[model samples]
Target: MTEPILPRIRPAIAALAPYRQGKQAGPDAFKLSSNENPFDPLPSVAEALQHTTPINRYPDATAGRLRARLGERYGVDADQVHVAAGSVSILHQLILATASVGDEVIYAWRSFEAYPSLPLVAGATGVQVPLTAESRHDLEAMADAVTERTRAIILCTPNNPTGPIITSDEFATFVARVPGDVLIILDEAYAEFVTAPDAVNGLTGRLHEKHPNVVVLRTFSKAYGLAGLRVGYAIGNVAVLNAARATGIPLSVTSAAENAAIASLDAEPELLERVAVIVERRTRLVEGLRAQGWDVPDSQANFVWLPTAERTDEIAAAFGENDLVVRAFPGDGIRISVGEEGSIDRVLEVAAGVR
Candidate 1:
């Protein structure tokens, strides 16, 4: 018999590994593998849930009211906002809308794992630019890598594996080099957790004003404590937003998710207060790790990156032994999310033992 054929599957899918989201391993485990908010959803969000009774019906297909609220909050019109199940959903849609077979999607290696996977799923080639030893994106190198075959670029600031962000000036210079037609998806999944004064706030108003190709992706998954809700949105020119929206899966956003996100927005001030605390503790974690002989990079996100080329497995094992489950990429070092202060201290203790 001949082999069964599934034409819809891209050839690249065979080689691509699926994204592995962090999960709770044991009942007593301090699971800091995923970068999620340590706190629960805000009281305002709970109240919104109480008042929301629309679960029996389908949510507003366009998410009009939430889009309007996002517009008012971000200084853009509702047309410029594209909401989806989560930022990853927005990213997947962006790749689907822009790329085709043989096209290239460029991003920093050791950044977000999803960046590489999205391109392959779009039937496009993935171009992974390696991050520097210091764990920052080499924007100049990335800009030079763009060719006529390139369709899009995914720039993750406060980048995933390594947590530093691209500065505003650096982004401006980088954007100038890329051709105007190439789509740029700036993933700011950890924007709310970033304390750097110069952090590029994801091409929202500024980048959109200058370049029609730029789109900023954000989510309520991290700082808002709504990872379970799976809500994210993109801010860009209306045409680009519409193009991305066109590729979305059917009825992706639920009424509960929409209500939760809107509630998150209403409680932004209180949420920001928690962000401030995490920032302070993140600094302490970095300093303590560095002091203990760990080659930890300065992180802008709510996580710490340890640069271990060979000892990645051993370090991850040690953490697991201590009931602290950190995330481990193949060649990259371990990434531990900044949970509660005590949880971070436990990770530091595990690090101390590893050192």
Candidate 2:
């Protein structure tokens, strides 16, 4: 007998692959596949979670308190701050809000894995400008690629998988060349870990004030150790944020997450000291990798990029055999998060052999 027909699906979505998360490590292994903070929730954050109330009621759709707190921290008005379940959720909302079937979204390649997929899911064409040989965004090439069809552009500073940051001067120059009408999303997911003096600080630098189309996306997932809570926010012009809010899923940011985020802010100094520890560990790991004769990038984030090139799979396998799980891109390289201190020696040991 003939099989029954199935419901129709969008051709673009039908051909698209879902986002792939980093591989989980076994109980005996160190999980460095995801760029996660190597610390536990602050005591204050934990205490805040204990006080969550009204389980039967829905969360504040506007995330008012959290927005006000973040706005104060960033020196922006509360209406300019938009909180979502995670910065990634804000990304989806922004893409859906600004882009459409015939429009285009541009970003650097070998950057965030999610960048390409977001546009496809939104029915917009994705334009990828390749990174420079140094594994940094080729901003000039990116500027050249923008056309009238371009609806949005994403700039991932202290870029994922590869850790170099976009300097303020470079970013300023790039922004000047782009058309003012296109929406620019600056993904600063790892901002708190940045120690580079010249690196672009979207919030403090007041980039949004200069470029009204620009939106800065940040998260508590990295430095604040709130990955599981999924708390992140966007600082932008009020109108742009409202558009993103329109596209967002209602009440996605739970009250518990908001409370924990507020508490994390309250304990920022203590949590930042934890960040300093991770930064130190990252420096040690990078130095060790360099001593092993590896051409590791000068990462400003809490991770290092090993340009293993054709040897990516083999090196990744070597790391896995040592019970150190890392994120590997088949033809590119591996991105190892600076995790537990104990994991570093093993990482260096494995790197020695790979080199």
Candidate 3:
């Protein structure tokens, strides 16, 4: 018997690899692969989640209340704030909204692993500019790379995996060179973890006001410890955000997630104290790694990058064998999130052995 033929698939999508999440650890291991908040859900968030009702009903497709609260915080109109399941979901929407066949989306390579694939899924070409030797974006090269076909550019600050923030001065100069029509997405998923004075503060810096084309993406998944609930928001021009909303799936942000996010905001002080603890731990870990002769990047985010290069697989395996799970990019580097305080010693020990 002959088998039935499969329907046609988009060639670009067929060739594209799905986004790979950070590795999970066993019960005995610390899950430092994903840059997640080490603390559990805030009591306020938990209490708020308990009160969620109307389970049979769809969520507010616009996530109005959350957007309003975010708008008040960011000094933007409610229309300028758009909430989605997560910042990543918003990324997909924004890419699809602005890019199309024959368009180009430019971003620094070895930045977000998901950046390259998102454009391909939208039938657009991805143009990756290489990161500098310090594991930071080469903004000059990126500016030179832009062409008439460039539709959007993604700048991930406190950049993922290799954690180094794009300085505010650098971003200002880069933004000036880009075409006014091009959309600039500042992905600041780990913004809350940054304590560096010079780092770009997208939320409060009023970048959107200065650069009408700029849109800032933020998430509760990291600092708020709401990763499982998937709540994030974007701040941008009303028109641009509306275009993103048009491309989004309806009712993707659940009521529970919205409530939890609001509660998290209400309890910001305590949540930020937890962030301070993580920042301290990150400093300790980085210092210990440097003492162990590792060339760790000066990360302002809640993680550090070790440029393991060809030894990435070997070092990652060594970490795994020592019951420490970390994200590894073969022939490149390793990203170890600042997790439980107890896990830091073990990480330093394993890293020391690798050297």
Candidate 4:
């Protein structure tokens, strides 16, 4: 058979791999790969999802109610809030709005998997600054790297996989060093789970007021247990958020997601109780892992990072064989989410052997 010629494809897009999710565990295995809420949905969330809104019609393109609620909570106008299917979607939208070919998007290395991926989608090159030995953002180096071509900068606090958060002081210093014209994205997807006293609080401090170019991205997926529903929001200057909206697919935020997000907000107290449980589990996991002679990073988020060095793949396979599936990054480390209380002991047991 003769080979057919393929249509022209962008060299960058052709070389890129699709976003890799955590491995799916078998039926009997406990999946600690994805950082997910272990508890069932709150009553309000379930009730909201049962809404009789006819799905035949398109949803409110702007997600008005949710935006209004978020605005009220954050002390911002509704116009200052932007809602999307997920925080990750908002990221791509913002990057598309701010960057283009020859521009650069800067972020910490081995941070959120999406950070390295988003810029390319916008036809912008990604500038990944290496994380410090403690697995934290080297904000000083990042600030020093800023140039005229730097269009967007993403700072993942309570950074995914590695587990350390950017502190308030660090954020202040970094922001001051960077040019005001460049867009700064604070990806706080796991913000709700953070317990450190001095960690940067985004919307609560009215960040956009202090820094117009800065935007904070948060999601209903983590603490609210609305992962599958895909609702996320960004708080920033109305004009900046409007730019992001211009680049986004309209009506992508469904009615179900909006309703569920609102319900999650209404049941915030109850939802936070579940978060508290996860935080306790994180404390146990960190302390337990260190006791086992494993040098685990202190995680404010619900997941813990286990640095297995050259043994990363082998240790991950060992975990899989024991029916405890985790996320492994080749030679780097493994990220184990705080799962059921029973799984805690199981994870520690597995780490004991692997260590």
> Model 4 scores what on Cα lDDT?
0.92
Off by over 4 Å in 2: none
Candidate 3 wrongly placed segments (more than 4 Å): none
The per-prediction CA RMSD against the true structure, in angstroms, equals 1.9, 1.0, 0.9, 0.8
The better-scoring model by lDDT among 3 and 4 is: 3
Model 4 agreement with the true structure over 67-172: per-residue lDDT tens digits: 9999999888999999999999999999999999999999998899988878998899999999999999999999988999999999998999888999998999
Provide the lDDT at 304 for model 2: 97
| Weakest 10 consecutive residues of candidate 3 by summed lDDT | 10-19
In model 4, what is the error at residue 317, expressed in angstroms?
0.5
lDDT of 1 at 136: 94
Prediction 2 TM-score vs. true: 0.98
Q: Which whole-number lDDT from 0 to 100 does residue 263 have in model 2? A: 97
TM-score of each: 0.95, 0.98, 0.98, 0.99
Model 4 residue-pair collision total? 0
Model 3, residue 306: C-alpha shift (Å): 1.0
Worst 10 residues of 4 by lDDT: 52-61
On TM-score, who's better, 1 or 4?
4
Tens-digit lDDT track for model 2 on 214-268?
Answer: 9999999999999999989999999999999999999899999999999999999
TM-score of 4: 0.99
